[model samples]
Target: MGGEGENMTEDAKDPVTYEFRDGAAWITLADAEHGNALNEVGAAALWRAIQRARADRAPVVVLSAEGRFFSVGGDLASFAAADDVSAYIDDLADALHRIVSELMRLDAVVISVVRGTAAGAGFPLAAAADLVLAARSARFTLGYTKVGLTVDGGTSLLSATLGLHHALHLALLNPVLSAEEAHRAGLVAQVHDDDELDAAVDRVVAQLVTGSHAAQVTVKRLLRGAATPAPETALRREALAIREAAARPDGQEGVRAFLEKRTPVFPGDR
Candidate 1:
């Protein structure tokens, strides 16, 4: 479709790749030399691309990586090079936390398509997504504790997403789970063959775009914040969203289309 869409390259070291196609944006870790490791340059590049995606009005975002490794996580060499090692680590940690939190805050739905190994911060990157599609060849684990490092980048929030006991197990045990096992444990939503991973991600993006933009954003906000908000606050948030939806033209069209037995023509739709 549309000649496979445009693949825009960003100029930055360490290979942080991102592309915008149709209504979806894809960001893949391109640092194959280091097993797509998350170095300071790579992390900063990703953060910048994400901001670009937000500004571009993309309806959906997908995260993946080139090579056999999705990401091996942090770059120890970079940390070792810093003059103030502890301060550098703290700053890096803060950046990662902001990145993770922003993934949920972005209006569009974000999905992670994992193939091969996704460990440490990489695992949490997938977890922070609105949805995750993993290839049968994929593996997930928490590699932080094994490396004598505490988890960061909203690892606690990822644990909350996967539930307390399982989250604790991932952190403490650090055992790798195959894509099938991940799906079974509710960590991944869909699993496909290695050859079919790209198509599967496209299918998800297509399904995501079927909903009106407003509805998608509203649902994303609700789901992202619901578990963290107070009961009364959550209810109020939902009610406010409902009121906004009812006021949108698509909302009225949806109701009228249901009554008239015809499809609703949403605004900004081609």
Candidate 2:
């Protein structure tokens, strides 16, 4: 673990708090007073935090929020207040899209810890993570239509992951899924009791930190590649990545530890 403090920003009112510790970067949505709704400043600050995590070479990145609801999605009040709603949304979407792109391409394993309701863009943001862990009380819904908006933050990716039929049901109806239902629907990977959520996340982070960073990163890349439409290209990339991983010190150490029947201490772990 590392020191705990709010991320420094010129604007003290920024709604995101970022911290890097051990081999993980923790990004918390700090605007709980407003249900963590993202306004222009919050969106930009979130992107900056993601960029910082990428640059820091963290092996794992945890995305969580400070309030009961993970996020209510885009700040509707901000949008309403904007003189030109169209332009406001356009810029907000651009910033959020950049953050989504970074998360998709990042080598670090991304995890979303959801405790309460994740709606609209928030739902897609959680879906974008490599893995999602939700408290038993967590709820999720694609709430765009309810607000007279379409979707953003890579909702299409969620549709692809969930398959068209289920995706349509979620998008068109905006029905909330409980944590168990989300897991059944393939949206969340694990569900923990509300009281156990923090420990569960910590356990996962500890496990990831002990593994070979190079191999884990390569695996993430390979999985992303496999998810794309280009199978042949994805296979080729996977082959190259595996070979590259095998040449790295952590990979070599992993193999050696397995052969010796000893616990592996990856470079990042040290």
Candidate 3:
């Protein structure tokens, strides 16, 4: 991350930017204008970026974002605009699941740097990493329920990371957590002052890059092995549930209400 990055993706406007800098692979969420919303295209771009990092066998892989938000999760406007929202979301979830799976299976130390907001898919992506570093101003949330979608992007893994009731809190209430709050909940490994984040991450990355790569990968695999539901199974279930939910009346109402900036009168409200 410290070096002047050489472009890996041909177009600078891709959803993600991948580069080998220093001794690590840096993959940044580059679609900042729309809060780095994940859609099929972005998810595919992210998967390719992760694959590049995996292929490089980088000892340290850094996942970060540009602008204010890490990622706001799926693109609701895009879904609402699609002729078949269910199919669109299904494809999106499939793509995102692959990214999450690849990131977890990568034989490197993955670190997510959270500067602002990391909600919905962002939450699980960061949580899946070996370590998560956050700026003091960082925030986290899981607002899928607020939009009447079940959830996807490996969010089911939150239970293993945050415990059952805490995961439920995120899924049901959609409460936003400050970086300090997330740290207390064990999602964040380290928190730094807003401007000090890079330096802090740099130190950790330097340490990781010089450390034993096999030992690091072994540790990650061991811990992941202990996680319940097998992330793959959970991801598939989430994708199915989300696709079904997206086709439901509640989900449609939620998306319409969101784009219209109004309260959703879901089917249950009748």
Candidate 4:
């Protein structure tokens, strides 16, 4: 888990954009049309962006997305199209977990600015950060149950941080929670009205950059150590569970139903 292999070669067409300036590294998800859905390619690009921030020793890293969604999580269309859906989903899960692991180990203050929906794997993607700043328009949900897949991207570990009741509710009912709801549930650090979210994030960035970097980093490590286990094992469990689920009849019908824009008739229904 030290390193998640070399990142994909940087390309102009990658779905993530990384830029370092003013002591902060900005990593923006750029695949708006697809809602920045996590796939192997997008995951690798995101990994590269995280690695770049690490290389630069940025004091603060801001993770944001250009799309209406922070990310829609796994791309169901791709899942349905995969000739080997289980293998494909396993690979995607691994790729995303790699990113989550890196974020957990990163020295900088990792902040995710969520403006819209953060569903499925997206929930953990935002929650993995050291801080989550969200807009009033933001929403959070697991969404995995809807598609008959288990949670991945460190959700299994991260959800522990969110407490059992909240996690159970999300994993079971798949209800969408607003940013204020997320804040109330201790899932987000701050929530501003949509128009003011960027300004709020900028202010937080300034404070993080100007504060005692060493102290903050040490606190990050200390709190994380006390809060949860290493992300690798829990994440691996999620990845494996997802793969097995994806190979089952419920997973098959669920993914197909999602892609077909219809209600999923899960195994229990039959």
Candidate 5:
């Protein structure tokens, strides 16, 4: 495993921080104050970090976050404050989708380490990774509907990964799945004790870095090709749906209520 070095990017000050170590790239969501939510700036920074990781051609990329939460999803406070909600969502989706695309297309293996909660767009972020390692206490949810928003971050891929019925169940019910449940549903590749997570992740990365990089890359590409609906197509649909939902009255109310720490009274709630 690679030790952290001082080769941090200039944009390391952003909510998303990037560090290159040995043969791996470590991308951490550092905005713990807000549950590591992705605002427009964070989204853009993450996209750029992903691009840098690909350019570095690291054999392994580890995505993790500071604080208890992996991420609570997009920053709804930012969304509620935007003058043009639709445009705001479109921009967010654009950056996030690019990040997802890069993760899928990169020759290196992408790993997501989930600790606390992964919700909304966060769910897709974890699901997009080639391997997801979750702490025993970690939880997952597709929380889009709670905020009257639709899915983004290439969640359409979930249909293929979790099957149509299970995917729809998640999308509609928004139940939080524990690490064990997530692994059973194929969302997480492995679960580790909270205390052992870092070591477990390091072990996996060590194995990858020590193995045949070319063979790993070839296998990844082959498996991705075998998946249906094409990542590009799924991303496009997700972007459009998110934009449309953000423009709805219910979406607006939901975001506002969330930021205000109140129950959302969506249209027809009365």
Candidate 6:
């Protein structure tokens, strides 16, 4: 279990303040004094880390913050200091959205371990995870409207996953929901005692690691395909994805192993 904690200096003022570790890549919003506000550098770091996690075939990844709140969305202080608000906002949104979208497309499972408050972009980032295990003390809110701005970072997509009416209420009302409520509303997968969250996450990750990588990737692609376009179109993607999986050497080995009642020898195994 490598430590998912790193401190890197970027330029002179804006430093890269997150870390990736073990088979589980992670990004922690460490600027707690500023509410773990999302900034351009942090967003880019997270995006790159996600890419790394995919290339390395990490079993599971977790996103958390080291503070009372997960993140207060974007860093208002940096935005106000920027000379070009429009460009900054666009760049920030693009990076953040890319991270979330990539997480969705990746084969490895992602989990959000929300300890306390996860508001604005934080909420959607959590929602984007394949699984969200929120601490009993965690609370979530789409706090964009309260700050006089529209949503970003797949907030709309995350909201839509919970159905239209509930999403609309979240966007319009911006009221916070307890972790248990979030689970009941389908926003989060489970809620654990704050002290037991790390163990719960570890168990989930272990379960994911025990499965066949080929099957996991195939199913993930199928699910994503089913979510997009009409059933006919989704079925086409599913067929294509399954066909590709079947053609792989590992898939062939798996079938043969099942027939022979032996363990499958996956590709690249010695």
Best by TM-score: 3
lDDT of each: 0.72, 0.76, 0.88, 0.87, 0.87, 0.68
How does each model score on TM-score? 0.80, 0.80, 0.96, 0.93, 0.94, 0.76
lDDT of 6 by residue, 64-92 (tens): 77779887777665655567554566567
Per-residue lDDT of candidate 2, residues 1-270 (tens digit): 234443645454568878887668999898889898877888877887888887777889999998799988877666656776556666776667667767877889999999999987798888778899999989998766544346666776665578888888887798999999999988899999999999999999999989998998898788777664442333333334433444455545554554466766666324
lDDT of 3 by residue, 138-206 (tens): 999989988899978888888898999999998999999999999999989999999999999999999
- On lDDT, the leading prediction is 3
Regions more than 4 Å wrong, model 2:
1-6, 9-13, 229-270
Q: How much is the lDDT of residue 85 in candidate 5?
A: 88
Q: Poorest 10 consecutive residues of model 5 by lDDT?
A: 1-10
TM-score of 6: 0.76
Name the TM-score of candidate 2.
0.80
By summed lDDT, the worst window of 10 consecutive residues in model 3 runs over 1-10
Q: For residues 107-216, could you state the per-residue lDDT of candidate 4 as single tens digits? A: 99999999899989999999999999999999998989888888888877756677887788888899999998889888899999899988899899999999999999
Ranking by lDDT: 3, 4, 5, 2, 1, 6
Relative to the true structure, candidate 1 has a C-alpha RMSD (angstroms) of 18.5
Clashing pairs in 3: none
**Clash pairs of candidate 5?**
none
Error of model 4, residue 50, in angstroms: 0.6
lDDT-better candidate, 2 vs 6: 2
Clashes within 3 Å, all models in order: 0, 0, 0, 0, 0, 0
RMSD of each: 18.5, 18.0, 2.1, 3.9, 2.3, 18.4
